[model samples]
Structure formats: C-alpha cells, structure tokens
Target: MTKTARQLQEEGLLYDVFEQELTDIKDRTYGLVSELSRASYFDTEYVMSLVRKIVAKIGQDSYIVPPFRCDYGDHVFIGNNTYINYNCCFLDSAKVTIGDYVYMGPNCNIFTPCHPIHHELRKEKVTEYALPVTVGSHSWIGGDVVITPGVTIGENCVIGAGSVVTKDIPDNSIAVGNPCKVIRQVNDKDREYINSLILDDETKNSKYKQEHGYVYSAKDEAIFNIVKDTVHYVEILNKLSNSEIQRRRDFLRTFVAKLDEGAMINSPFYMEFANHLEMGVNSFINYDCIMLNNAMVKLGDNVLVGPKVSFYTAMHPIDAKQREQWLVYAKPITVEDNVWIGGSATILGGVTIGKNAIVGAGAVVTKDVEPNTIVVGNPARVLRKITAEDSKKYQEELAKQKDINKSEFDKMMAGQWYNAMDYSMLKLRQENNKKTEAYSRITINTLSYKDRMAKAIVKEFGENANIIPPFTCDYGCNVKVGNNTVINHSGVFLDTNEINIGKHALIGPKSGLYGAIHPFDVEARNEGIEKAKTINIGDGAWLGGKVTVVPGVSIGKHSVIGAGSVVTKDIPDDVVAVGNPCRVIRKITEDDKINPIRKK
Candidate 1:
C-alpha cells in the first residue's frame, strides 16, 4: 500500500506526491502574493489581514512588506516584533520558523528543498524531502543573505550582508561569507547594550529620516531629475539621421556615470538613477531595458543586454508600519564583461552575474551566477557552463541576422509598408514618437521658436515657413513646406503620407489633413493595418478653419476652400469650394481674385 504524504513526512522519509495536489495550494498563495505586491503602501491593515490568511502562524505585532513570496505559506511561522524587507523569496517546501525581534533585510532568500545529486533521479522527479530552518530571537539577517535548507541561526546572531549560509550557526555568533562560518562570538557584555537598543528609536524620528540619507537622499533627488530628462533625450537621439552622434554624446554626458565611447542604448530605455549607472566600452543595449540604478547598475565591456531585460535595485521594508510611509532601500546590480542577457530576463538587486554568463530568455534571476555559466527559468538555476566554442557560435548567429535587421529598417524609410512588429521598425517608430513629444512640450510662441522646433523634425522646413503653436503630425519628416507658407494654430497634419505644400499657402486654424486610411474590418483595425496616400496643395491656396482633407485628395493652385468643408475629392484650379463632401460652389469671384492668399 502507498504511504500518504503526511505519513512519509512524519517519518522524515523521502517521498513523491502528485505535483498537481501541491500546486493547488501553491496557486492560492500566488493569488495572495499578487494582491500584496500591488496593494497601496498606505493599506497597512488590509495587507496584514492578507498575510494572516497565508502563514500558519505570525506574531500579532509583526508585519512584512509587499512582494513577499513563499511556496507554501502555511509552512512558514514568524514570532512577534519581527521585520522583513521587500522582494524576499522563501521556498518553504518544509517548515521555516522565525523567532521574535528578528530583522531580515531586503532581497533575502531562504530555501528548504534540494534535488538529489544523481542527475537521473532528479530528472525523474522520484523523491523529495524538506528540512526546517530556525532563527533564534533577536537575530539580524543582513541584506541579500541566502540561507540554505535546515540552517539554524542561534539567538543574538548577526549574519552580514551577501553571505550564503549553508550550515548551522551557534548562539551569540556573527557569521559572514559564502558557505558561511562563525566569525566571532558575542559575550554577555555585548548583549547588554544590543538588547537596550530599540527598533523604534531610529524609525520614529521623522525629521532625522528626512534630513539624513536614510531615505530618498538629496543626491538621489538630483539624479532622479536628470534621469527623467535624459530618458526623453535619448529617445530623440535614437531617431536622429545617423549623423547626430555628437548630440547623443552631449546628452549622455548629462547623466550616465562612467560611460565609455562607442556604447549605445536603443531608444525607450528606462532608469530612475542615472548617476549610479555605469557602462563599459562598446556595450550595446537593445530597446526597452529598465535599470533601477539607485545603488549602482554596472555593465562591463562588450555586454549585450537584449530587449526588455530589466535590472532592479529598490526595496521596501517588511513591516507594514515602516512601509506605510514609503520607506525603502537599495542594492547594486552588476553585469560583468561579455555577458549576454537574453530578451525579457530580469536580474534583481544585489545580484552579480559574472563574466560570460548567459541568462536565458524570460528568466527571473535571484542569486549570484558564476562566471561562464548559462542559467534559465524562474528563480533561475544554472543549466550548464558556457564554453569558448559557444561564444563563437553566438557571434556567428548574430552576424547572420544583422543583414535582415538592416533590410527591415531600409524598407520602412523607402515608403514601403512593413510589419511594425519587426524590431528595427518599432525602434524607428518609438524614435519618432520621442522627437514629437519633445517638440510638443515646447511653447512655440514666435517664428524663431517654431523654426527651432521645425528644424529638429521637418526635413524640408522652408525659409519663412512657420506652423503656429500646437501643431501635431504623425511623422514630421514626411511633410514638406515651400517658401512663405503659414500654418495657423491648432492644425492637425496627419503626415503618415507625404504632405506637400506650395509656396504662399495658407492653412487656417483648427484644420485637419489626414493621409492614412484604415480598413473598416475589425480584425484589420485591431491588427493596426493601414494605408496612406499623398496630399498635395497648390500655390496660393487658402484652407479655412474646420476643413477636413481626406487621403488621396488635392486642392488646385490658387483655389479657395471655405470653413467647415470636407474635401473628399480633388478641386479644380481657381474655384471656390465649401460644405460637406465639398464641391466647387462657383468659379473664383471678383473678391477672391482681388485678394489672393499671401504668407502671414
């Protein structure tokens, strides 16, 4: 007869149970994790209730921050007055018991399940066993420490930051380093002063927390502002005509600490603290990498962080009371030389991925990865070592694909419709969006300011041609203006297709010129498929306010289009047109002939 999971567990014997049964309970814990991760920082009481529903036992006074994760919440127990910081992962396949008055710092990890050393057995998933972990009262586990299965930390012990404890530590001991060992023992005299200190003494002093660099320091504020500006600035640079390398360098100088020449990050990169970010020579980052570089995000030479790879550094306290005021701390993230991080991978705080390490796509890394290793999956584990031959193969594959990327980029610029999902095309679109945002932010009150803005985006910005304030367009580069053209304020130039304006043209306020036509079918619209046709306006043409010119439509030279007109078809030269689905009401009258439209 088969023994039940409870029976095997009681006997301390290895056993295999259906993974689906265990997963059902774990799924419920994930629901709670999601709620806590997204809950408002001020909802302290609500967050505590959610925690109580998960853990088998927790002290009444203790609280933890959001974004805490556990495999089986009921196996974990906490004592009174304990504090935990943000983004902690507790893999409690077995019991984890914490004593009272303990402090576990940010990004800490506690694991209690290990696979068999025999590869064949591990692959079969034949056996599983868990060992419980214990920490005595009044102990402090520093930031980024990792405690392996069954490690018993004794009373009044201090585990230094970044230590990996694989063995038990005795009472009154201070331990530090990988495969942690006891450093020194604290005697009764030391315990006297330590016990006298209270956690509230430093935290309750609001003025001290604000003034000192304890939270959101003065330097941090400065770095944040510069990061905001540069974040937008880099997007514009990415859209430049391939000759504006100097402008990119000038923008990079504003923030980016310790950057070497020849390094480039694709547009739409994200970061909050630029002063702590470092990049070495020739490192190229693809689009949309988020680096929360508060402590420091350091990248070594020849690193290639692919699109959507994110680096995190910020963390909040576990105690809901401390988290309520938005209290937080940070740790550094380091990526060494020749590392290739795959697309959509996330490297968290206090992680140092060593040189030549390759993180697989969509992996979520939590711990330090050794040099020349390949890791993949959630809570990423080492898959294999990367040999020198593997690096050569990777280079060859990328070299083969470089031509394909350049082909897509060229097709978009050549007026041919292409797939927007293509990497190079999206990069170009985001680049254009960035420039448009910057142009819109400026107050274009005068012709000089308008010219300054136009020069940045418009390819054929003619002499003395001015578009009034609040002009918007899909692609400014597609619009061309002849000499002495005046576009009035609040005009919408949908320039997905070519918009060619002759000399001495007058575009009235609140006018719209649309060139792109979308399909009526729902699937086509949802897929974002569209076609654009050119719009041409003749010399000395006058367009009145609230006029709408559809795609493939033209107004003849010296023609007059009246207010509230919708031009669906071409109008002949020297005619006056008005009204919906506009047609020529009459030939140019004496009044129209006498007052030809002139540049404002």
Candidate 2:
C-alpha cells in the first residue's frame, strides 16, 4: 500500500514539497496569515481571536505581533504568557512547540524544513524532510535568531540575538554565536548580581527606596497609586495619532519628571512610574519601546532609541520562595549623551551605558558599558572601540558634497535635513512611481521588456543584472545595480539616498534596504523634514531572504548576511554575519570549499 505525502512527512521521511495535500495546507495557511496581517495593529483582542484559528493551540495571554509568517500553522503550539514580536516566521513543517513565559524577539525564524544537500537530488524532484523544533519555558530567544531543524532548547535558557541554533541547548544555559554554543550556565551568581545592586540601609533611608536600588513592595499603596495614574497617561499616549504631536508632548510633560525640548517619544510607548523617567534634549524614542521604570530611567542628550528597545528597571528575587513572597527590587538605568540603542536591545536594571556607545539590535546588556564602545551579543560584550578614524572617514565623505546652491534634493543627498514634501521632490517621486508601476505590469515572460523597464528605472543598470517583478523603491534614479547581480522577488529599496550594489551580488527575496531617516525633533518630523544616508553592497556579496539593511550601512565584499538579519552596523569584508544587530560570526576561509555531500 502506498502512503500519502502527508503520511510520509509525518513519518519524517523525504516527500514531494509540491504534493497536492501539502500545497493545499500551505495555501490555506497563507490566506489566514494575510488576514491576520490585515487586522488593525491596535486591536489586540481581535488579533488573538484570529491567531486561534491559525495555530493549533495558543494558551491564555500568548500574543503574537502582526506581520507574522508561518508554514503549516496547524503544527505550531504556543504556551501561556508567551510574547512573540514583529516579523517572526515559523516554518512549522513539523510540530513547533513554544513553552510558557518565552519571549521571542523580532525577525526570529524557526525553520523545520531540511532539503537534500546534493543539488542534483534537489533539482530532480523538490523533495524535503522536516523535524520538530521546541523552545522550552522561561527562556528568552533574542531577536533575529534562526533555530534550525530538530533543535530543542531547554528551560530557562538565553539564546542570544543573531545566533544560529544548530544543536540542542542545555537547561539554564546562556548560548550565543552562529552555530550557537553554550557560554555559561545561569547560576546563583546571576541572582547575587541583582541583589548586590541593593543599597545599604543608610542610602535607602536618605533616598526614595524604589529609585535607589532598594527592595520595595510593588503592592504598596503609594506605589500602586503612582502606577495607576501612569497607566492612565500611557493609555492616552498610545491612543494618540502621529499627527497629535503637540498634544502627545503636553501629556508627556504633565506626567514625566523632565521632558526636555526636542525630545520625542513615538506612540505605543509603555512605561511604569512615568514620573521617574527623564529625557534630555533631542532624544528620540521609536515606536513600541517599553520602560519598566520602577526606578529612575534617564536618557541624556541626542540619544537615539530604536523600536522595541526595552529599559528594565524592575527585578524580582531569584529565589522561588522570595519571589512568591512578592519581594521586588528596582535599580536606575542611565544612557549618557549621544548614545544609540538599536532595536530590540534590552537594557537591564542598574546599567549605565556611557556616552557615544552603541548597543546593537537584540543585544541584552547586563552591565555598565564604557564610553566610545560598540557592544553586541546576548550578554553584550564590547565589539570595538570608536576611533578617530571613524570621525575622519565620515567627515571626508561629507566633504565630497558639491558646494553649489543646494536644493532640498541636494541637501537630502548630502545627508542633511531637508523638506521631503517639497514640490520638486514630490514630482520626482510621482515620475518614479509611474516607472515602477509600468515595470510591475510587465510579465516575467517578456525578458526584453522587463530588462528595458529595469534599466529605465535605475541610475545605472549593469550587464546581466536581473530584478524580479513586484520590486519596490522610493526613488529609482538613486539606485545603481552592478554586473551579473540578481535581486529576488518583493525587494523594497527606499532610495531616498544612494543605494550602490556591486558586481556579482545575490539579493534574496523579501529583502529591504531602507535609507530614509526622520528628524529626532518632533516639530521637524511633523513638518515633513527628513534626511537620508547611503547604503552600499560590495562586490560578490550575498544577502539572504527577509534581510533588512538600515540606513548608512555597508556590506563588504564577499560577505554573506544570513536570512532574517536586521543589519544596523557595517560588516567588514569576507565574513559571515547574522542576527538583529547583525554581527560577524566568523571570517570566510578556503576550507569552506569542502562540501559535505562530496565527502559522503
């Protein structure tokens, strides 16, 4: 008796991916995913209701952010109180189970499908197999992580950002890096460190106990009232539209201790103890940022806090007995002037990030960071120190700007603030839109027509450069594609500034290159003022599917960016990088030439 494709898949055997049974399931899941994506962002209750129809089982209080993608949604199960953040993809060809209290950061991909290593076998029939992936309870899976087939993460583990989990992780371990390895085990020292931040009796008596690193009762009458009042203000702030800039500012000033001039916090912000927070001049907090500011949380001048960045000032006793007793402590967090904290990065209590420091996306900073340093990883480590050369190089680049009477477009190209709503800029975009629309209308079968349309759209189109249909870009004339380059489907290039792609580049599907930036000042932003920075992709580079490259970034020659990575910093030549704030895992070597299939 012959077995069905679904039966073969369930048995963990290779099966035809395009089998009618499998395709039908995938088609159904895609429709549901699209419906969920279309749901209003603020409608949490409605979103959860739709989620129940998609996944096999989602326990109480398990919420998944919108714009999520998955294959075979019926095979996925999530436990209670689990929070899955934005743009997460779970390719659950087999069962994918997530345990309770798991926090999965943005752009994380859980892949269960495995294809044949041999190219011949893959091309012949499109056959593949799948294995289950399980993430344990009370674990933190950092943003942009890729969990490969058949992996099991044990309970209370911390899987760091940009890590590729190729194997099982032990319980209570802290693991990081590509092909992730356990760095340390969660021990009593972890709890002791938080406890050590508690103030002495003398200090606690003089200062506000909650703000001075003293353990305080969360349920205390005074503290509860403060929280209650703050919640009222926060809800109003979250509900306010982007156009209500002045109103939002007014509300913030009334509740927050110090709301300095030019400081802007985007809507959907969450905070506890609003009066304990302080913002310096020109500090910008992006959307969905959360501040558990039980203690004082301060941001110095010119700080750029990215989306989903969290400042955690509240902590509970590590001992189960004490935790049950509702014993909690709070510690202050400070970010000095000119700091840039990337998206999804978490700043723990008692951490003071010094001036001019960069906290990479998805980084979990636990300790104080020194000035002029760049940090990344789960337990964030100093990646490099900022040098004079960095300043010099940027100055040199800026000097190349032509000194003629500059228009708004000229200012935009020079990375200076300019009016994006200017008549000339609007005309250019309208023309560019027409070209893009025409290009999109042309079918793939007409290769010559498509090629001509692409050439007309970009500034310089090199020989043999191919871009699939459904391509999107803000301004096409600022883009330059090099020889023999291939950009896959659904590519979005926001070319408000220059986007230079070098020769022999492979850009995967659903990738985005964003070069636009808005002013930190709320007034300027509301006035339609904007700026842009150049994005450069070097020769022989490869960007994986769903990769997002932010403004002013450069991908060096012969480098490979893994799938689902959010690149926030420059990647040097000849390396493999991955994660939210993408970090280099290792340098490419000649030994990489050896293929396992050939060896077999």
**Best of the candidates, TM-score:** 2
Model 1, range 1-600, lDDT digits (tens) per residue? 987664554344455533565656766775676566545333579879888987889896787865576767988999988877554667677888998888786556776654332222322333446668898887878654668766899987887654557789998788865446787886555434322322345444432432232343323444435555654554445445322444665677666787787566754355655667888876667544556555678898867675546676755443333333335556688899777776546677789999877776545677999998888654578999867565465445434544454454343344343343345545655566566555544431232465777767766878777775445565677788877676754465657678998876767554668665433222332243345678899876777543568777889876877643557789988787864446787876444322111110
- For every model shown, what is its TM-score relative to the native structure? 0.42, 0.64
Clashes per candidate, residues 3 or more apart or on different chains: 3, 1
Off by over 4 Å in 1: 17-20, 187-600
- lDDT, residue 178, model 2: 55
Clashing pairs in 1: 64-318, 65-318, 84-318
lDDT of each: 0.63, 0.75
Worst 10 residues of 2 by lDDT: 115-124
CA-only RMSD, every prediction: 26.7, 8.1
